[model samples]
Target: MIERVLAIRHDKIGDFVLYWPALFLLKSALPKASIEVFVAPAVQALAEACPYVDHVIVDTGDDKATSQKFIERNYDAVIVSCSEFRIYKMIRHLDSAYKLAPKHNWYQHLYKHTADAQYKQGEACWRGGCMLVEHFLTQHGIDIPELPQQYWDLSAERQKWRSYYGQEGNEKLIFIHAGTGGSSGSLSPSDFANLSTNISDKTQVDCKFVLTYSGAEEELAQQIFDQLSKKSIKVVMAKPLSSLADFAKSIVAADMFIAGSTGPLHLAGLHNIPTVGFYAGRRSAPIVRWQTLSHSDRRLSYTPPIGKRTGKNMSLIDFNAVEKDVVAYLDANYA
Candidate 1:
């Protein structure tokens, strides 16, 4: 009788988004249970927006206070989706009957249940997360069903942002984020500008582009804006929003999203919106490993070759080939 369950994934925005399916499956297995999550302060708003989560506790980086808060709740089960040594230290004190985590650290023996998130070359990060949850449930004599593609009903958020952005006459809105957030390799402003121009010129669909950025990325976004302006493409800079949750709401208005493997791209995945991602050509960060959480048919990805000169080089990814495939994707889906 796991009536109260707590899951912890206090980490990056992209990783949090990828872990949704695991949470979804957990809720499905224990429908009547009260499911809550502990998250990083940076993703508090986004975590609150998750339909699968009932409550979100923001880790203020104070281990004592945060642990005390959860300790009062007396959760029956705890699932550490993204395990950290710090997390283990705090939750180890929790009197929960069942605690599950991956078999990663030496301290993993602290967990009552530990499962191997069988690491393999070029596998999606979320697959391992799902394995952890499935393993925990099966050990408890609960049957786990196959996961369906996930989507959020953000219609109100969509309507609110679409009203603000103001689409004219059935134009398909495309949001392009040029900065990499220092997470992986990405294209130059010139490359993004040229690709946008090619899509506008070649695709049969009537498309409007919104250049999105925050912090230091403003310069990168502006450069692409200027280039597209000179090329006569229908483009505009996205209005700055107050928070990540607000930005995610704006993404709901977009028909498509494009970026390097980064936070904003995964925000679009929350809606299962069509996505185009540029991934680093490393074995650990392959196109498949970091693919957007969108469904298979909704995502298209590109990466440079895996080698010394090419692996981290975004310039080596053939943008011309990318442009052709993007144009074809747009025409097929939008036209």
Candidate 2:
């Protein structure tokens, strides 16, 4: 009956966010099933906030403790959303009837079944996770539907955040996140400053730029903040929150989000917020491959030219074109 299912994706925050769509499909397809998630400690808070999840098990990197947690649960199915050898060793001993993962590496054989969820040139990474879940359901004689769009009902949190920040009702909130998390190269401070200025000048609607940052990237964000302040733009640094979940709640109020491919950018995607992302031109991390988990109409991306010399080079992207397109999008939708 597949009464209990454990979906594992103990990876980076951004990748975990992308896996939400697949998680959505799983819960929708099997509503009666108790769906739990195993995630890294850093992602535990956000995982708990997910509407589709019933329980969240945080991987504390203590092998014996983690193994005990899994053994006690005795899941009916284990879907390794992001396959890893370490993960294989953790769950292989479980007596689950079905253990599914992508057809990758020799380690994949540890799972009871494998699906062709291999990454492709132009497919969103989430689709591979979707395929794995879909294959699992089909094998058990379950019918699944097309992927549905997702939204969060964060009205209370949004209102509290807006009130706390003194966000004016008339101003459109645009969050500009300058941190790249080192996953991909990002635009320079000057590029972000110019783009923010272009947006302010071109969009008819009143806009408030919120500069979001974490850790040592405070310098990067401050650089953009300073440049925009000199131009007399309405910009402020996003207030620090207690946790990643709280930060995500704050993002629910944003009318638009802009960042290089990073965790915060994907957190904005959780609300289906209109997102504009700067991506690496490399094949593995192209705009299409790591696209935010928003509806197609809500996402806009830019990247450098594709090649060894330019693929990961942020300077090679056309900031002018990006600025124009972003301004146009804001005018058409929000204005």
Candidate 3:
């Protein structure tokens, strides 16, 4: 039995969140195994919060030291998920009984010739229909169990949400996320203004618009809030969420989620919240990969080509296409 494991995935918030299912499966398969994770420092808190993880080692620029530390621990196996040259090199030097990672022909030279196992990440596509997380775990001989979707749960966050927007029985909450990091996933200020106006003009319900985004998008969030305020839309911006659980709770409380293809969209799916995804440049890859829950519907503005160069060559989709989908979703689900 695998008594100790090291799972390495050093990526963004959404990347880490998507691995929840795999983490669950690993824990179930080896209940007694001490699972340690090597992750970006920003996401170290998330790894520590996971009940399955026994320890978390942050990748703070000292690859040799990190590998040495793992060697000393005498881990049974190491699972590498990062697609970085530096990370692959470090994993190759680690002394583990078994090693598993996504197979890439280009990087074969970086791994030990006798590496115990190598799993291809794309195996999910051929498995008919399974969540990417499940696909990853199954490759490692782990079975996924039925678990309530994972979310970051923060005690004070709920209270803060309640206090900021007085919890009235009649209030209808609609969450809007307007910005993405350095991409067209950000709605033009005018598009956001138009959307907020349209919602108020068409709906008679006691509607409120909630703004959510990382601190990096503060300026854009403010712009959207100001536009909605002019339309007399009740707007609330909670402090940036402290954990994935807090973000999930905020999405769960909403009647519907309207956002670009970003972290909130995925979180909405996890919570089974109905969402209108306003994808910017092209079709989102994750939406196509995972089977949507019964409550979810995806409206892509631009259907990207079916190849590796797809998203790179696409131009911005017409805003009218986005407006139609959002309006249709709101009318059907909310009205």
Candidate 4:
């Protein structure tokens, strides 16, 4: 059995969130093994706080230093969750007896003599057997009883929200998250302004709209906040949270969440909160993925059906379509 494991996944928040199952499995299988995680600086704080990890190393963008640090660790096993290329390179530098990596096209270069296993990411089993996280564990001869939708305790986070809004649990709270990373077309400030204004005008509920995002999207967040202010929509911006637990608590305390396929959506799923997820494209994958793991959420994609096949183009999803679904979901679940 492996005695020490070095897990590497230096990527986004969602990437880290998806791997929580795998981390739990590794710890359960090798109870005495020391587990160290390697992640980007942005995610280092979360990794350090993970209950399953023994140590967390931040990637400083120095290949030589990183390689030397790995070499010095002398781990008995290295499980690279990021990708095939990183696994291959890291294996060559380590004195590990086993290397585990997800299956990909680049597997041809892996050493034949070393103990290796093929893992499939995002695989779902009908008996709840296979999933991206379980596949990794099964490859390592470990079986997990259940895949937990991971969450962090946000009692403090709840307090933050309450203090910021002066909310006494009497007023209805609606959180609108418009910050999605990468190339996804996030809701424009004007769109949020219109939606919040329309909701307040049409409904007589004592509602408050809060906008949340990582500081990276500050400019866009500010624009949305400004637009909502002019319409007299009670808007609050979430300051940078110190931990995922804080973030999860804030989401759980909210009455309703309307956001993109980002971290907040996953948080809502974990907390069993009623959520409306807005996707740029109309494919059912996001909904299917979330629904398989959660019970109290709805997904709305922009892509429309054409003939026998669904359109792949995401541009077809309009602002009106998003607003309609949001309103419908709030009416059905929140009302």
Please list the residue runs of candidate 1 whose C-alpha ends up more than 4 Å from where it truly belongs after superposition. Answer: none
Give the Cα lDDT of each candidate: 0.85, 0.84, 0.61, 0.62
| CA lDDT, candidate 3, residue 252 | 56
Cα distance off (Å), candidate 4, residue 304? 6.1
lDDT per residue for candidate 1 within 1-335, as digits (tens), equals 88889999988888888888888888888888888999988889988888788888998889999899889989999988778888988888889999998888787887778999865776777788889889988898999977766557787677667767767777888899988953557789998898889899999999899998988898999999999999889999986899888888788899889897478887898788999888888766657777777888888888889877788898989888888888888999889
Score every model by TM-score: 0.95, 0.94, 0.74, 0.75
Question: Which portions of model 4 miss their true places by more than 4 Å?
Answer: 28-32, 84-87, 111-136, 139-141, 153-157, 201-205, 214-216, 241-252, 261-264, 267-272, 282-335
What TM-score quantifies how close candidate 2 is to the native fold?
Answer: 0.94
Output the TM-score of candidate 3.
Answer: 0.74
Poorest 10 consecutive residues of model 2 by lDDT?
147-156
Off by over 4 Å in 2: none
lDDT of 3 by residue, 191-285 (tens): 76677677656665566778777866767778888887777778877567777555565665666677664566656655565666553333444
Highest-TM-score candidate: 1
lDDT of 2 by residue, 63-124 (tens): 78888898899899999887889888888788888889889889977666999987677787
Tell me which residue pairs clash in candidate 1: none
Which of candidates 2 and 3 is the stronger one according to lDDT? 2
Of 3 and 4, the candidate ahead on TM-score is 4
Could you list the CA RMSD of all candidates, in the order they appear? Answer: 1.6, 1.7, 5.1, 4.7
Clashing pairs in 4: 122-132, 282-303
